[model samples]
Structures are given as C-alpha cells and as structure tokens.
Target: MHHATPLINTIVGGLVLAFLLGILANRFRISPLVGYLVAGVLVGPHTPGFVADTSLAPELAELGVILLMFGVGLHFSLKDLMAVKSIAIPGAIAQIAVATLLGITFSTVMHWTLVNGLVFGLCLSTASTVVLLRALEERQLIDSRRGQIAIGWLIVEDLVMVLTLVLLPAYGKLLGGESETMRQVWLDLALTLGKVAAFITLMIVVGRRVVPWVLAKSASTGSRELFTLSVLAMALGIAFGAVELFGVSFALGAFFAGVVLNESELSHRAAHDTLPLRDAFAVLFFVSVGMLFDPLIVIHEPLAVLATLAIILVGKSAAAFALVKLFGHSRRTALTISVSLAQIGEFAFILAGLGISLGMLSPQGQNLVLAGAILSIMVNPLMFALLERYLARHDPGDEETTDRQPGEETQLPLEVCHHALLVGYGRVGSLIGARLAEAGMPMVVIENTRARVDMLRNQGINVVLGNAAKPEILSLARLDCARWLLLTIPNGFEAGEIVALAREKRPDLSIIVRAHYDDEVAYITERGATQVVMGEREIATSMIALLQLDAAKLPY
Candidate 1:
C-alpha cells in the first residue's frame, strides 16, 4: 500500500528536509533561507531522490504568497512612507530602472526577445520584502533611519509590482500577437485598471469600516481562537473576492485586506496571531521556489547565471548606492540602504511565475532569477558584516554620530544611568514593568516589536526598539550604566546569550532571568544570571504559603 498521498508527502518531506538543512545552515552561521532553498533543490524533481509532488507545491506556495503579502499590508504605514518619500521614491525608481536595464542587457545577450527581456528586467527590479525585513530586524536596524528608508523604498517597489501584476496579462497579450488590435489592447488595459481602482476604492471605503468592526466584535467575544479565525477569514476572503470580482491577484487582494485591517486598533494583535501560520507557509513558498530551480543551470548556463548575479548583487547595489548618495544622505546611509537592497526573494518568484504563465519568460529565465536570488541572499549577510567592519575601522563614531531623524523614537537618552534594563514587553515583562513603574523606578525597555515600543513610549517609558542580543542594541539601552538586567523573554537559549553578554559588559550588574525548566535554570545561571527564577518553583512556594496561612487561621 502507498503510505502517503502526494499532498502529505510533499508537505512532510518539504518541511522535514527544510528543517534539517535550515538547522545545518544556522549552525554554520549562515542564513536559514539558504538552507530552505537548497532543501527544495534536494527534493526537487530535477534531483535524484525523494522528489516532492510537483503539482501540489505551487498551490501551497500561493497560500504563502497571500499570507506574506497580507503581513506586509498589516505592517504598511502610509505616514512612514510619506516621511521617507524624499529619498525612497526617487531612489527606488532610479534603482529599478538601472537594474531593469542591466537585466535587459543580460537577456539580450542570451538571445531572448525584447518582450521576454522586458519581463525578466521587471522581475529583477523588485527586492524581496521577506529577506530584506529579516535582515533589518536581525541587526536591530528596522527602527533605524536607514531601515526606514529601505522599508519605504520596498513599499514603492511593492506598489509598482502590484500595478505590473495587474497590467501584465493584458500587456503580454498585446505583445504575444493575441490582441486583435491596438484598440483592443488599450481597452483591456483600461478595464484591468478600472477593476483595480474599484477594488482599492471599495476596500478603503467599505473594508476600512467593516473589517475593523468585525475585528472589534471578535475581540469583544474574548475568544482567542475566534479572533484568530476571524483574521484569517478576512485575509482569505478578501483575496478570493478580489480575484473573483475584480480580476486582481491573490497577493494584491491580501495586501489590500491587510492595509485595510491595519487601520484597526487590533492590527498588532492580528499580525501577532497570524505570524506562525504566515512563517510556515512562507517557508513552503521558498521551498517551492527552490523546487523550480534546476541546479543544472549553473553548469549548463554558467554565464547566464553569472550575468544574473552581477545584475542582482553588483548592478542593483551600485544603482541604489548612487541614488541614495545623490539624494544627499551620508556614505554610511547609502551603504546601508544599498547592502539591504542587494538581494531579491519572494517578488522575483511571483513575477517570474507570472511571466512564465504569460509565455513571455522561458523556463531558463526563471531558473536564472532563482539562481540569482539564492546567491544574493547567501551573500547579503556578509555584505552587511563587511559594511559594519568597514564603518568600525574607518569611522568608529559613525553610528553614534547619526542622529535620529524626525518621527523616529527609538533613541534613548545618553544620560540614562543606573536604571533597570528590561528585554521584551510581552505578558511577563509587562507585569514586571508595571510594578517597576508603580514603584517609581527608572527602567528602560529593549523590544523588537514596533507596536509594543509605541505602547511603552505612550506610557512615558524609555524604550529601544531592537533585539537585546545585538551589541549595538544593547549599547542603545545604556547597558554599561544599567544597575539591573531583567530577562523576561521566554527563550532560554537566547536569554543565556543575553546574560553572558551583559555579564561580560558589566560584571557588577545584577542580572535576573526567568526560565521554564530545571535545565534552563542551570543554563542561565551558568551564563552569569545573578538569579534564575523558575515558574514552577515560584508557583509551588506561593501555593504552600497560602495553604499554611489557611491552616493557621483555622486554629489547627
């Protein structure tokens, strides 16, 4: 008997291989993304063994794209984009043009048609939102000025891609010798644009009111499961509705759904709740992209792959760097933005897929884009590391001298000293913070979540929006001057690192950490935590005290 169906085998195999390779990559201090893509290649049809269900992967990948775009929409900020418009808009446009031209040149050299070249160029123009965000967040730069500009630039790229996705089918028809006449082509274009406009208008006007109302009602029910289900329903429902009614893509619909829901007070909760599912599906998406990449391309078309890499890593970076510098930013800022944008990921896959579907891009073109994406992602972290080392060696005070621009609030006061430093602002951390605030103690919080950072600031607390594990972020929290360091985040291994770093930085600081298990207590304590607080022990002690008090009151 067959032990597993295609769907089951694909998911289990894809996830299992991705997990193993992803761990291996992380162990080697490489991005898990490289491992995920490589996992796809290993299980791909082009591979020798354990080929996954080819038909099932793309369907799963579509869900990933929808959720990923929805997440983008949930976090999209019009105000933030407006703030960086001066540089982000022009820089992104110019950079896209430069990259597209380079891609066209490569396509021409490969003997592809102008239309194919155009589609390939367009695919190369956009950067991967997933990879870019992860890179920025890992380094604790998402709230920094450079991060803002990079994010804003990505938003513009996304908007352009959305438009391209909408118009591409019609444009492809026009170019594919399918349109009856130029008039018909223009008419088709008008209809597509009209439908997109109507969808956006309805979403902004109706969805803005209805989505929030629905979410508020779901919240009022006080059922976490119901709220989560409601958020998913909205995302999927809107996306389905858009395709059914407006001829918009699932990604575009999901993006608009997220943008509309982003206006709700519950947006952060929506994002938090959907994150796990989003990440899982996103992994599948990357794996699917990998499955499409034939490794033979590297051997069969080495120069094509080389040209693609040159365009992605060199040409694109150069364009972004020049544009940012031209916009009057510092060299450091230019480098930061350039390095951040030096890779492509999800959008490239989506655009390449669309181009293939339209019969404009050959399978070879898609493979080249995939190959380029993998190489660029692998090199991105190194690029950032090099930039950091360069800055440290040549301009030791560059990061310190870069002042916070207007509307940026992650900056901590240089004078803050002898205060308690709290990492994370989740449930346990919030309780501890409230107590500290009520006791009139000075405290600083280091959090990576933007929403939580806003909440903390609104309560008149000083906060740094970044991961505490990074030395730069730790520096921003004034760890050297901190009297106490509290680890309220639940991850034991991560807490150990933070404790070890804190102890190394300031040996006199009193460090308190919370853990869930016995081994975690030992692990954290050994790593220099002055006190390791265990939940089970604390609960047991409290219960024992209550029982004893009751017995004494009963005159036993």
Candidate 2:
C-alpha cells in the first residue's frame, strides 16, 4: 500500500515552508509575498531539497486564480470605478501602453520575436491587485481620493488583462503558423468574444437570481458549515461550468460568479467565510510561481533580470506618475499612484504561464518575470516608506491632517462635541453603543468590519471603517475632539496600543478598556488607560455583593 501521494506531499511541504518563510519575512519588515516566493525557490527542483509535485502545483495554482478573481469580483464596485473614471481609465491605459513599449524594447534588445515581445510586454504592464490592496488597507488609504484613483486604475488594468487572456490564444495561433489566415484569426476572435458575451449574459440574467436564492435558502437553514460550503461550491462550480460550456477562462467565469453574488446581502458573509480557503490557495499560487523560477538567472542572465526589474519598478512607475500628473492631479497623488503600481504579482505570473503554454514566451522570460516579481515586492515597502517621509516633510498639510475636519460629507456628525469614540463594534462594544444611542448621546464607532459598518450606517449610526490601531483611522474618528475613548475589543496588547495613541493625541481624553485577564488589566492601565475593566474581576465583585445582601436578609 503505497500511500505517499505526491499531491499530499506537495501541499504539505509547500504550506509548511511558506509559513516559516512568511513569518521570517514579516519579522524582517518585508512583505510575506517575498517569503512565499523564496519558499518556492527552496523547495523547487533547482534547489538541493525535497521538490514538490510540479504537475499538481499548477492545477492548484489555477484554483487559486479562480478564487482570487472571485474575491475581487465580490469587492468590485462599478460605482467606485465610475467615480474616478475621468483619471483612472485614461491614466491606466496610457501607463500600460508605456510599460508595454518599454518591455517590447527590452525584448527586442534580447532578440525575441515580435509576438513574444508583446506577450512579455503585456505581463509587465499590470500591477498586482493583492499587493496594491494590502498596501492601501494597511495605510488606511483605501477610502481616500488617492486610494480610490489607484484602485480604479487597477480595475481598468484587470479588465484589460482579462480580455487579453481571452484573445491571446487566437493571436498566438495566427502568429505561430501560416495555415491560419488573418480572416481566420478575426473569426476565431469573434467566436471567442461571442462565447464570452453569452456566458456573461447567462451569469447576469439567470445566475444573479439563482445564486442569491441558493444562499438565502442556505442561510435559512442556520448552518454555518452549509453556508460556507454553498459559497465555495458557487465559486468552484461556476468556474468549472464556464470552461466546460462556454469555452471561457476559469478566472473570467469565477469573476462573473462573484459579481453576481455581490448583489446579495449575504455577499460579505460569503467573502468572510471563504477567506481562509482563498488565502491558502492564493499562497499555493505564489509558491507554484516560485517553483518555476531558477535562482541561477541572477548569475547567468543578470542583465535580463535587471531589465525586467527596471520595467516593473522604474518604467511602469514613471509612466503612472506622468499620466496622473498630466491629468492635473497634485504631486502627492501622482506619487501615491506611481508607487502603488510599482510591483507585479498574480496576473504577471498567469500571463507568463499562458505565454509559455502557447509557446510565445521562453523559459528564460518566465524566470525573469518571477525574479522581477520577487525583487519588486521586496522593494515596495521601502518605496512606500520613502513616500511617507517625503509627504511628512514636504506635504505637511496632507489629506490625513486637513481632512479630519467635519462637514466633509463624512458619516460623522458635524455639530457633535464631546462625543464618545467607540472602538470595535463587536459584542461588548455593541452593547455600549446601544446604551449610548438610547440615551441620545453622540457616538462614533471605529470598526474594521465592512458589513458591520454598513449595518451601523443603515441604522443612522456614525462609523469609521478601518483598523483602530492605526493613527490615521483613529484620526478619522476625531480623537482630539472626542471626550471619551472606549476600547471594547478583547485583545489587551492591541487595546493598549490604541490607548497610548489616543492619549498622545488628546492628553485629556478619558479612556476605558476591557480585558480578559488580570495581567491584561494591569498592562492596559500602565499604557495610559484611565479604566481597565476585567471580566473575572467584575463577576467576582457582583458575586460578593450578592452574598453580602443575602446574609443581611438572613436572621443573623
């Protein structure tokens, strides 16, 4: 009984190594993406170690692509894209053109054919959505004008790449042989487009009604496991059906499935429920890409690796900066957008793989793309750090400071003064918020959950959506103007950080924090919490008071 399945071995090995490296990367203040790639290289065939099953890795990586695109579709908002269309659409197109041109010039210098050059160029033209979103969310910039513009631009780039993915095979066939005429190429393209259009129409018309109904039924059962299973089934089922029936890419099918599901009220739960699986597969996707990379490229083809990095870090960034500035935006906006786009990730790897499958890209090109992705991801945080410093010194009155004022059409009340700033809208915080609302007291909630924020807003409660640990998010809650800061989240260390920050921002602000342990209470209080309420301590106090009352009621 030979039970040593290669699939199991690959998954186990990849995940364990990736976890170890990811932690190391975080410890060093580097993106976990860099670590994941490094892990892949370590377990790769090129390295002196246990190699994973390369054959199964790609299939798993495809699943990751489907789930990743589906998640994107869930968060996708046409309204947000339209709001910044004037700048985002044109700026993204122009930047992609510039990047592609630079990539093509480099490819030509390397003596590649025009078709190969175009494929290579296309890979370099787009930025990684995962990296961009993580960066923006970490900085609490996801809702800012600058973040909106950058996100909108990335959306445009994604749509273009999706279209390219659909059309590339036909283009490849035409370029590969004389048997395929230009007319044949156009005909094949039209047929592919027709299938895609038909698939999208089915999703919008029928899927929109069916998916929500399925989820609603699943929700009615009140089974968390069933609901999670239903969401995953929808994602994977639609992806498979699209390829089997419509001759479309799994990524496109999964994306449209997500867009359809996004219309349902259960969409947030769907996203949250399936996040763990999505994240796991996404990591595997990165690991698979790393497996394809040969570290000797740095030694054997250093110039080619450098050229790829230049296109990603310098050429693409310069184009984005020029495009944003040409649209009459400020220097800060230009810099933000530029730095945001200065890395490549999942999409680049997907494109590179497709190019290789179609015989349009060489092994060397794929390795170069992988090398560029790793290096650029490693350098991205430094770029952001430099930008932050520049803004602090030169643009001292940047948006974070100036935009804190009320009457900016924000959810916070303009007339409210000495209001309570409530952090975390979970169990304890929600109870406190309900009491304050009943008493007609002014309150603003700082919560990171989007679904909770939406619910609060619908009830006419003011809420700020972001991690409260960040100063910018706290600033958005107007800490200086707040009279009381309440930390209802259970994490003692995190709560302490928030207390310290609030105290520094407003020395006179009263702070109350909840803790689960006696040591946590002491820790929070030492960090400047005016009051630390421990659950066990309060329970004991109530019990003692009740015992005394009972004794007094007795004859004694």
How does each model score on lDDT? 0.82, 0.81
When superposed on Cα atoms, how far off is each prediction in RMSD?
4.2, 5.2
Clash count, candidate 2: 0
Local accuracy of candidate 1 as per-residue lDDT tens digits, 1-556: 1788899999999999999999999999877887888898899999898999877887887787778778767766445546799888888888988888887888788889887888898888888776787677567576566777988898678767776776788787667678457776677667877888899899988998899899989989999999999999999999899889987878778888987876565776788688788888878876887887778888998888888888988899999999988877778888889899888877788889899998989988888888888778778878888988997787565353463454455464456888999997777888999999999888999976566677778988889866788777888889989989999877787799999998998999999998988999999999999999999999999998887766456854
Q: After superposition, how far is residue 81 of candidate 1 from its true place, in Å?
A: 3.8
Pairs that clash in candidate 1: none
Error of 2 at 524 (Å): 7.8
What TM-score would you give candidate 1 relative to the actual structure?
Answer: 0.82
* TM-scores for every predicted model: 0.82, 0.79
Ten-residue stretch with the least lDDT total in model 1: 398-407
Model 2, 300-329: lDDT tens digits are 988888989999999999999988888777
State the local distance difference test value for candidate 1.
0.82
